[model samples]
Target: MTDSFLTISGFRKTFGSIVAVEDVSLNIPKGEFLTFLGPSGSGKSTTLYAVAGFDDPSAGDISIDGRSILATPPHKRNIGMVFQRYTLFPHLPVGENIAFPLRVRGHSAADIAKTVKAMLSLVRLEGFEDRLPAQLSGGQQQRVALARALAYDPPVLLMDEPLSALDKKLREEIQVEIRRIHQETGVTILYVTHDQEEALRLSDRIAVFNHGRIEQVGSGEDLYARPATRFVAGFIGDSNFLKVREVERRGSAASAILPDGTRIENIPAHAGNGHAATPELMVRPQSLKFVQGSGAGLAVKVKDVTFLGDTSSVLLETGWGQEIWLRGAGSAVKTNALSGPLHVEWNPADSHLFC
Candidate 1:
């Protein structure tokens, strides 16, 4: 943490009566790809804007390499930004657009041209330098925007949904380019997006935001496999929450009875302070499996089955009329199997208890 390149400490932002962000702090090491991921109005952008010197925080400090930049102007902060829109100048050709930043910084013409060429090659737009922004496709324009942002050799790059405007296939393709650019330049990146899959694909670590605060921060695998809160568990992946009543508690291990009176033991318990919140068992769809007969499993009736390419989705209704989904191998469930009573079971270790 002492070597952290970007540090956000006790960050808080407010808009008169509305609090946009609340006491969020993070330490980002140099050259790491960190993402702010969450739904709309979650304060991820607010934090990023503060770092970019676009908005002054009501409280807290943001520092780069241990030096505070809060007193600096937006352009004087020496940071790069790529927004959702490809903000390339329409009249400028790709080469000139890329040279804009370096030109403004008073770099010599020779150095600007050399840097533009290298940047074009970095984004894989080697021969398109002569074309104007209006003549390029959406993906190509965005690539040019990226090249322009990196032209000045900024220490940090802030991307706010840079790929959100493209189609799915194009977005994925550009994601690969973005990753390569990050590696080639070694510039610290702080990306923002609501798409969880994109965050998982691009980030070294992700910060999940909700209601003006960070819910959790971890690797994609960590967030998916071992979520700290019910919000995080539900946000990062597909989950099924089943209502339950806690019957026993010993430290972090506890036992709970399902709605159908099936007692499950040794599950990880959280926030069990006997609050008004009801206890629920959180299980991933992939963790639930069909156990042969009615042998020590929850009784359910199959309602529907959907066959995806690599996996099949099976929907089942519990005896108490709660519906849940299970994902299995493509051939795991069949249409003919829907006629009889089905029982599903999961290991207690694979579940989390939340109240």
Candidate 2:
């Protein structure tokens, strides 16, 4: 939330007749961990490439510390980048790999040696200095890549799915290291990933991209709890959207009736430009609760239930044949008792009416 340290203004990129990225603009503060999150071909990588000088923008400007970097070449930009694959020099040892950037910048041998030692220690690879890229594990190789990228003490670091090559456990382990390095080094990081959980765990703020445009930007909680668009609602977390009818809107508060004549009132609603699409009630799986009687809530027949460690996932079918999921404490409902008819209800305040 500080003054803008890295700015992208009206950035646009196109490939022949197709548009890769629209006019995307964002202001990033110094030392902020911002993530560009979206599915593949959603313009996240295109924006990151523009920042790293890998691709030229058809329009708009990219500035760092109040100076435009559009005219600067990639090497002169002094920016660091790590890609999906580990781009380590196979013939060189870890120490030399970490020292490559420092050498390129014309640092003294003594300075390079000192920085290499510190960088190795920062990545928790203290004694692996003499090991080659082939000798180290995938995660360790990435740590070395990270060390190499930071060797020149760049002002900003750009990561493009750097952990996608690692296994789940290794990926999670390296995520912790990345966070620690970010805190210790205080470098502004622009990370790109399609994994929502990764973005939620790592970013100080997330920019959700969709179809060559940025749909929303906010903290994980903000996007999950109050999404500005239906796409964001469906992307940020697990959501169950039930079709609703007879929507009456007055300001931000609205009421609607379900297909089974269950009335919900005084809920937050978004009537998008007075469109005629059927409004949907967006609710999280955890927000629903099972009641005993049919008169209390929407009547449903339990289709299936799966016990998942600390939680239970229940799949239910409504009278109109719409399937929805409900997740709750594993011990809340017995497996044997869930087969019959049940009623599911949630607080009206917990749902959003999205048109």
Q: Say which candidate scores most in lDDT.
A: 2
Q: After aligning candidate 2 to the native by TM-score, how far in Å is the CA of 163 from where it should be?
A: 0.4
TM-score of each: 0.96, 0.96
lDDT of 1 by residue, 64-134 (tens): 99999999999898899998987999989999999998888899999998999999999999999999999
Q: List residue ranges in candidate 2 displaced over 4 A.
A: 271-276
lDDT of each prediction vs. the true structure? 0.90, 0.91
For residues 202-270, write the lDDT of model 2, one tens digit per residue: 999999998888888898888889887778888899999898867888789888899988888888887
Q: TM-score for model 2?
A: 0.96
User: Which ten-residue region of model 2 has the weakest summed lDDT?
Assistant: 270-279
